[model samples]
Target: MEAWKEKFVSWFATSGRMNRAAFVKRFFGVNLVCMAAVLVIGSRVIEETGSVFASNLVSGVLAALAAVFLYSPMVRRLHDIGRDARLAQAYLCFGIPQGFLLGKVAALPPGSLGLYAFEAALAAVTLLFIVLVFHAGEPRRNAYGAVPGRAAAAQQTGRKKGRRLKKAGTV
Candidate 1:
């Protein structure tokens, strides 16, 4: 438990480097926080004034902007863990269709077990994909640049060398 806590702290403190578990945990935590905020504030606003559309629109826009801004850092963190940014694109590939299917199911006849089965399968597959992303192999140096932890160490060494040179008036 201590080790796990240390890993979380390290991942959060480091600029981009994070292990897969840490990355997944952080991603899920962010999503949960966003969902909670939307649920609480949106529910209050709607209950007080009965404007479901407005509340939904506001929450949707907020979530979209958060996703857009958070994506790059998330990608960078994935790179640090040795995964490709394309892995993050799984949501576009699988999640969108699943969401559409869900909507279709909701609109179907009341006694449709078929849609429920399909939805369950889709949910399982989505969960599997999330696990796969977290379990994917790490790269040595991905397109995001060198591995962050190593790069930081190298930078520190360079700075130390520069300082020594300066002290010797040979820089």
Candidate 2:
């Protein structure tokens, strides 16, 4: 229980760098969970209550809760790439509202221009985020923290320097 507490607390702490693997796990894992929850729990709520608004309310709450876990990991990924955490805030400012708008527009008749536009915008934003997560990260320490396994790269650099010095008879 204590270990779980620490893990949960760390989820929101955006102070350290995270590698590609950790970033994918936390970000995609939470997103998958949230999607599953909305699909499963939300459908059940609607079926039982017979109110789509209530179902949407439940889904929104779940998404907001999931966002609590998502924002920090995104910030950590930005740190790993030597970028500012504030970049993640754009999702909070725009993405959430866009999501709501998307849902509303999704109900429109097929071939609606607004639906396609919103979908394209959402896809573009999602693609940008996907590229960020998958982009190769800096493998050394930065303002946030050292990436795991990056120390070996630094050691290899040091060894190369030592070899050069030896060849030049400086050491």
Candidate 3:
């Protein structure tokens, strides 16, 4: 738990050195929280007044904003995992269209089996890209500097530990 907190705080602070597992866990965690909030809030709004359009619109807008805020951090996390930020663009290219189609299918009256099928297919494709991003190759010396492993080792060894000077230009 402490490690998780540390990772979260560090990512918040510097957006640095997240491994594959960490990146996915954090990404999924954030998305899950956002999704759950949307579901709950949207359901409440619809149940209270039965305005599907309004509820859906609000949910969509919130989700889009959340995604906008999340994308940069996620890309940075991917960078920490040694992957290119361009991989993040995959969702924009593929997932958005699929999601739009799914939204349309969901809005259908009934007999929307095709929509569900399409949704399943989209989910599979999205998962595939996510897996690809998680398993993407890490560069040795990225623009962010050496990988986390080396930095952690250096921190542990005290070799690169920073120290305060005792007297101005002396020591």
Candidate 4:
């Protein structure tokens, strides 16, 4: 139970390492939460209200919060794989806005260059994140703290004791 808490909460931190399992799990979990929020709030409430500003406000607030929560975990996940966290800036700064732009462009005449461009960009960004989330992180710690699976246990005990416990097959 405690492990689960730590794993999920790691989404809010940008300076740690996260193994593939934790990254994949949180990736899906965050998507589910975002979908639920949009369905419940965006579709049901905002649409029914029929106010464009209200809808934008609600959705924008939700999107911003989601980005805030997702940004750190994404950076850390990149770090775990021995990559610069700055790589995530592309997705955070451009990919997400491009997604919204894609939707609007969809209403434009078919075969619009802008629509195709946005679609291509969004696809590339999604693929990048998919690959990153599934890729195995550096086996031993590189520079971004220890391997997360081991780091959590090590954090619970003194480093020496943690090493001993790992050797004893208890951690």
lDDT of 4 by residue, 1-171 (tens): 999999777557788787778777877787789767866887766558887556555666666566666777788889988988777777777635643453366578878887677777768778878878668888898888788878777667787787899999998
Q: Candidate 3, 104: how far from true, in Å? A: 2.1
lDDT of 1: 0.61
Task: Score residue 72 of candidate 1 by CA lDDT.
Answer: 51
- The per-model lDDT (C-alpha) reads 0.61, 0.79, 0.62, 0.74
- TM-score on alpha carbons, each prediction: 0.56, 0.74, 0.60, 0.74
lDDT of 3 by residue, 9-101 (tens): 655543455566656666677678778878998899999989987676767766665555455556666676566667566544544444234
Better of 2 and 3 by TM-score: 2
Q: Write the per-residue lDDT of candidate 1 for residues 28-78, one digit (tens) a residue.
A: 776787778788888888998899666766576556644543455455565
Looking at model 3, the pairs that clash are none
Instruction: Give the better candidate number (1 or 2) by lDDT.
Output: 2
- Which candidate number maximizes lDDT? 2
- Please give the RMSD of candidate 3 to the true structure: 6.4
lDDT of 4 at 168: 100
Where does candidate 2 stray beyond 4 Å? Answer: 108-117, 149-171
Give residue 141's lDDT in candidate 4 (0 to 100): 80
Clashing pairs in 2: none
CA deviation > 4 Å runs, candidate 1:
1-26, 51-59, 77-85, 93-125, 136-139, 168-171
